[model samples]
Target: MGNQVNLEEEAVGRRGREVQRDGEKRGLEGPKVLREECPSSRDLLNSLRQVEKMLAVHEASYQQGLRSLRKKISALHNSTMAIFRIGKNASCPKPEPPGHGRRLGRVFGIGHEVHFLCKPTYELIGPRTRVCLESLKWSGQQPMCRRVNGTSNSLASFSPAAPSSSSSSTSSFPVSAALSASSSTPASSSASSPFTLSSSSPTSSSPSSSVRPSHCTHFLGSTRCTCDVGFTISGRDNNICTDIDECLLFPLGQPGRLCVHQCVNTPGSFHCFCPAGYDLARDGRSCTDIDECENRMHNCTVDQVCVNTYGSFQCVTVECPQMKNATYIKTSSMRCERNPCMLGDKACTQAPNSISFHFLSVVSNMSAPRVLFRVSAARVLGDTLRFGLAGGRGRGHFSVQRSGRQTGTLLLVTPIKGPATLEAEVEMSELERNALLGRYLTKVTLFVSLHEF
Candidate 1:
């Protein structure tokens, strides 16, 4: 019976295991089935519509928040820049402690003014007050304190006696400190001192109180100071300051003047300039064309011509004849032969017996008769040929000269009558071995006509 119970228990356990296996399989298949069963298109569309409505409801608020955030960031950035004076350090000048003078407001800040005062018996020179300019500089130099009598030097002797009510009232704490500092320096009285002023006062000192030359009328204790950047100290002691000309000191490609052409130095400033053929551009540093031809500044005459070049113009004289119907042919270095005949007509002809030539008529209003024609020939027969004027009866009306064995010139004088024709004849005797072999004759005809001139 026990065996039977044990077998029954084993059977029951096996059946429970099979049931558990089936449940595990169903659990794994559940997710796969759900994944395969996609939602309907209509349901997806409905969900998307709801999302759109929600996004539309929040879009305006989100954009408004973004704009507000940007505004806040920009304001913060600007405030931070103002506080730090970013990008302004090099452009702004630092404050300089005045000697024997009183300064008000922030000296280092732009648009701030500084006023000055002198001791009772001293007078002030230069502007009484100066203001800081946008260029980061004081408007004027520091004023000097001179004695009332105008005979006291810049470093006048002062007694260490108790100050008078008037002297104490006029001097401020800063001014007094500056004056004291300026007076204590040994350089103030030296000849090398730039602030050394002439003194006409007689040498006189009281025995009860010791007196020393003082550059300051009030007490301000400080040592020598240097000038700001772009400035140099002048005068003997290097107390007088002046602006340095960067254009003159440094050339292009250096750390100074940026001018491309010429550089001009002005008071406390400098500028660029261009050459004669160029003009100053709107930028004031660059140069452009002056356009001499376009501006009618060229010296070309009517017969001459003008051509534009880079930044300048060129004057060119008409080298060849510019007549409408004539074609120019170069005949010599100094003259050009012009042909005015039609395409088929012969302008010049040469032959063994007769040579004929044609030239365009020239009309002039001048009184003097000009040379109408010129001809020259080279001898091929050595001394066997003789050339002379022949067919014209008015030979005396023209001047003739034999330049060489085969060369001659003909000049036409003032004509007494109308048109005339002239002819030249050449007679040649052929020779061989210095003996005559044959004779030949050549003739050339020239026609000359004069107008009313």
Candidate 2:
């Protein structure tokens, strides 16, 4: 009985070895061959199990043979399981490519990677590359290619908000470590092989575009999407938020606008901007006129007076005129009063008795035929005054017209582009029936600014 059991055990062991070798060879033939041959290998193992059960009836007599047969069966079962595992891990499911982007590497075998690239003017929103894992899953999240918003580049005035805590630090994936720990097969070992999808021909498939951002927070049994400080919720979905164009919402010319001069729209907020001669106020939503004269920001010389305007400043120089028989006294920085002279002095009566200086600042290329200055007699009792433009560098651009019996007006006929200094003198003669009694001259200085307020 012992010899019979030993013979049966040797035959079974020999058959098991042959089946193991065939299974090993078939497993090398790829997953398809292993799948087709796996059933036969299982049937052979069942036959060996039956033989071991039949010998178990004479357990004490054929203990060695039974033990040997069981060992062979165990070895064969382990080999089959290993082969099955290899076949199962042969490949992973192919992942979908991102929209407006192209993917490389068609082979979906374990440890294999696929690279993603965005089209021109589009941005990649997720991982650039993904690797296949032993669990038959792709590493990291699926990537996407989104359209690049023109607001990012065109709106250079936009100030980006600080990064959130979750996005402040980047975290790296442990794909390589995971790959190393997974069981290695013939396909997995050569995972570095060149198996790339065509990147030259980009896919033209269109995907659903997101209109708003997806940033949500959960609290008190409720979930809400929150945008940045300057952003607000958009649409009825309540899952996303979009940027608020404050500049468009509150325009410059509108009554309740944010800025006094100009409003610049950012991604999430808006910025107030003042014109050339103004500054942004402390409130950040309004603009304040810059006091160039008070701040000493004017370029006036030491001999010139700095005068502030609506949005600019002007520098003017006033000096008492020197004439024969005309002694002038300084009444103010811009006024010159004639000293009392003898009534018989003809030169003093002929020349101007009082001369004053006036300064004005205007923007470049102002409208034509604007009344710039008015000259009126302090007191008049049926007295006539003749007003005319005296000889000066800026006489050609101005004209003096008699407005009333004792009043005259200075008209700017031509607009001047600046930064330039225009000097014009207005001579007012006190007359009684065409006879000149006394004369008064006024020097007018116009400071044309380079910028239009």
Candidate 3:
């Protein structure tokens, strides 16, 4: 009975062991079964890795293709640039030279050069030479020929033809004798030269005898020639004589000018003229200012006063304002005095104590904000004083500003057209602690002339 019981226990232990083994096998198989139901993790990971590798390859290929395209574009740009360069190197358009000028060098290509020249009387204004560049353009600006500003000093010298025996005495005529006659002659007369042969000479009988004359001296089969006082020989041809333009040669502001204001050039001489409001003095080159006011040359009316200025004259007038209960007295030519006001007369008391007239000449359209006139009190005993523009036709163009304790300035605030009159009433008020003392009115008349100087 004991042996049987021990065998039974061993059997029971073996059965329990077998049951535990079966449970462990089921646990392992459970995961395998679930993995089959879904997708395998290892297969999924391998597929994702392959797809990533394919995408990397595609990206690399795309980048390589983009690089290839960029290279082709660069090559095309280079080819186009080369073609443009070739076209530009072929030729350049011909340039036109200025009037009275000529250009040298016929070829117009890259790195080529050209030169310009002007006539004898003209002057070259711009670059003398220019070069064609690779960019198909000239290197410098096109040259121009401009007429010279002053007269030329070049002389024309020629040998006089052999004089006949009858006229040999007059061949060496003295220039001094002709100078006196030329001075007395008018400038508008034709040019007369002492070197010219008279019609009575034997050589004058020929129809082709040259009438042009020059100062000449025969010495040992060689002749020396010269030009007269007011003439010079041409640079190109020594046989030709040209008049000297004294006006252009000696312009204003330079020494040796013919006139103080204006110089008019003629065939062989020049004339001096003075500007308006001036008289030509005894000395032909100088000028004297004309007193239009004294001479009564102005067109001023009886009410206007004639004022003289440099190179011009002006007419200006100022009248006292008409007001009720006020009486004005003419103190002087340019001043007026008011009678003392009555104690009960408010209108007379409020009016200006004195009114004065002033005339001034100004250039047309002068710079604005310029101080035109100044008003000042010789003595200041008031507590306060003020200055202002009262009323006039020119009030809009003017302003009054205080310059000092007892001085005020009338300033031109705006520019105005001239050949017209500008009238302004400037009033000065004296106050003792804000109480009105007296007001003086000044009637300023400005004569704006059309001339600048």
Evaluated with TM-score, which candidate comes out highest?
A: 3
> Where does candidate 2 clash, by residue pair?
105-197
Instruction: Order the numbered candidates by lDDT, best leading.
Output: 3, 2, 1
Candidate scoring better on lDDT of 1 and 3? 3
Residue-level lDDT of model 3, residues 241-283, one tens digit each, is 3455677877987766567788876544467888677788886
TM-score, one value per model: 0.26, 0.41, 0.45
Writing each residue's lDDT as its tens digit, candidate 2 over 96-202 gives: 87887766556788878776655654555566568888777889998876655534432211222221123111122222111101000000111121221111111
The TM-score, computed over Cα atoms with residue i paired to residue i, of candidate 2 is 0.41
What is the lDDT of every predicted structure here?
Answer: 0.47, 0.64, 0.65
Give me the runs in candidate 1 sitting further than 4 Å from their true place.
1-219, 223-231, 234-245, 253-259, 263-274, 278-289, 317-453
lDDT of 2: 0.64
Which candidate wins on lDDT? Answer: 3
* Candidate 3 clashes between residue pairs 3 or more apart in a chain or in different chains: 155-233, 156-233
> What is the Å distance of residue 313 in model 3 from its true position?
5.3
Find the number of clashing residue pairs for candidate 3: 2
TM-score of 1: 0.26
What is the per-residue lDDT of model 1 for residues 10-116, given as tens digits with 9 covering 90 to 100? 99999999999999999999988887798778889999999999998799889999999999999999977775674344233654444554443343566555555
Between candidates 1 and 3, the one scoring higher on TM-score is 3
